[model samples]
Target: MVRGKTEVRRIENAASRQVTFSKRRNGLLKKAYELSVLCDAEVALIVFSSRGKLWEFSSSSRKLLGETLGTCSAAELHELGNQLEESLRQIRKRKQCILAEQIAELREKEKSLLKENKLLHEKFKGGNMLHLNAAEVQSMEVNTQLMIGRPGTL
Candidate 1:
């Protein structure tokens, strides 16, 4: 019997809807997998049924597991190794650049903090404890004790 094109609408029967969803979801996932493999393209598919059941399919390389190595030539293996090395080099370069930027930022902060500490030290001079422009007492031998702590510490 030839099946005619059915109207696209919600299935009235819950059981029929569930069965249809199951069949169609499997078909779509299989198609996606086939497409990814045949085209060497990435495919990701997700399906949620009426009962909130979830099904997902994702396609990525499995060469890391040595599953597809039997089909590779020596040249292919060497090429793969070179690709991995290049990827590692790129990753290391990026990491080093980011670390350099962070170090530079931290050094700038340290410089600013040091400058502030110097200004604070100037505010509490050890000898006079108060700064005046071109003014001095006749007796400069008397001394007092003052306790000071570094910034960001007790």
Candidate 2:
């Protein structure tokens, strides 16, 4: 008969534990080999058994676990750095374009505000113009100052 489901925690029985360990160790090594083959990748796996036996596997011996991947020579490193720098430069160029557009929009808003201020000031002066003469303009300025509770020389 088949056994029921078992928890993944500590195995209690000693004989069953040994059998499980051997089976899992083989399975893990097989999986590592299959992964390296199927993915076309540099793979390394280090496994230590319960008896302290160490097992390791790698696709290449020269390019070990501690070694950097894909870059065997200084030329490769320089080429890779250039490619990365160009990509970053393109990203910065796009950011600069966006900021330039925002600056143009702010400048347009400033111009609109300046134009609106000029129009309002013209309208206020038109309404206060009883006569276009200099003396009449002076008198109007004095009257406006008095209305706003300001002392006027006129």
The C-alpha stretches of model 2 lying farther than 4 A from their native spots are 1-5, 62-154
Model 2: per-residue Cα lDDT over 1-154, one tens digit each = 9999976765889898889888988888888889888998766667777789888787654244345646567776676567557867997999799899879999999999999999998987888753478867666533352344555733
lDDT of 1 by residue, 1-154 (tens): 9999999876999889989988999999999999999999977665767668878887885453345878888998888788768877997999799899879999999999999999889777865557644445544556665447866565
How many residue pairs clash per model?
Answer: 0, 0
lDDT of each: 0.79, 0.75
Which whole-number lDDT from 0 to 100 does residue 82 have in model 2? 78
Clashing pairs in 2: none
Candidate number achieving the greatest lDDT relative to the actual structure: 1
